[model samples]
Target chain A: GQQVMQIPQYQHVQEGEDFTTYCNSSTTLSNIQWYKQRPGGHPVFLIQLVKSGEVKKQKRLTFQFGEAKKNSSLHITATQTTDVGTYFCAGQLAGGTSYGKLTFGQGTILTVHP
Target chain B: DAGITQSPRYKITETGRQVTLMCHQTWSHSYMFWYRQDLGHGLRLIYYSAAADITDKGEVPDGYVVSRSKTENFPLTLESATRSQTSVYFCASSESGTSNYEQYFGPGTRLTVT
Candidate 1:
């Protein structure tokens, strides 16, 4: 039973402010994926980090994986109203028969105020 | 019509009644997954199917059953729905079962059990 924990259950920031959410796992993860879910919408794949100490960026957003592959962080620069939504980090466990059994974190709800 | 889609965008059923949620994808993806999202919590995997005849249980698959009769269809069945099953269910599909694959999710089905 792998567990993924997320920080900042809720966050409110100005339109131009920056936002970041951290995620950790009790056990080592094979890979980590990030998702964004808009209010009243379903989750959409954002990115995935596989290698240790990996860092990937999508436009103004950056995602990082810990050296041990047990933690990750998603950071956004100059947040906008469109960035208002819940960010989730899911971990894929190693040696599991299921290939993509994503253990999702509690998710961090982000609200951008104008 | 080209991406993943779920049926009955919203549904309300009584406790102990049977309910089924339909999921279809046009990409002929080999991996399909079901997840439930609750307030303040991230999406938790209910079940997943690797291929048409291969299925496996996930973190929260106790009360849910999933079947993959074809590469394009994956449906979830709740034999006897309960209050705890009242939540937003999402169906996601990925072209590959590999850990690096990105998942595409449906619009989601909101189920309310009274």
Candidate 2:
């Protein structure tokens, strides 16, 4: 079975501050995807990282995948009040008959105070 | 301009009752999934379907049943609901059952059992 762990279960920061959430997987992943869920809302896909040591940016947010493909990190620069939500990382196992099933991490809850 | 959708955005029932959560997608995806979200547990997969009449269990499939009679419809049934089943359930669909494809999630259904 595959497992994913996330760090900093909860985070609170002032507006304009930076926030980062880390994710680690028990097994090598063929790909990883990030999702964000706002208060009283459903999870929305953010981005997906496939290549090892890949880095992608979306405006104020940056995502990076470890060279080993076993870990990932999401960093948000200059966080705003609207950025408050829970961030989740899901990993798809590399081998076996997985059929694209995803293992989700516990997630990091971020709260930005303005 | 249609996407995945879930029925009965909110539901409440007593223990030992039977309830069904419906999921519909217009993308005609080959893969569909059901996941439950709790406070600490990010998203635990309950079951998934790979085309019509093909379904498989996921990480947390106990006390739940699923059927995919059509390519665009997948429904989850709780034959005997319990208090522990109180959580938010999300439905997602992917273009194919491959790691390279991204999953699109539905709004989610909140259920509570007394």
**Every model: Cα RMSD to truth:** 1.4, 1.1
Candidate 1 segments whose C-alpha is farther than 4 A from its true place = B97-99
Identify the leading candidate in terms of lDDT. 2
lDDT of each residue in A1-114, candidate 1, tens digit only: 789999989999999999999999999988999999899888888999999999999999999999999999999999999999999998888665656668899999999999
Can you write out model 2's per-residue Cα lDDT over B14-70, one digit (the tens) per residue?
999999999999989999999999988899999998789999999999999999989
Model 2 error, position A1 (Å): 1.2
lDDT of 1 by residue, B1-114 (tens): 579999989999999999999999999989999999897768888999888999998878888888888999999999999999999999999877454768899999999999
DockQ values, each candidate: 0.77, 0.79
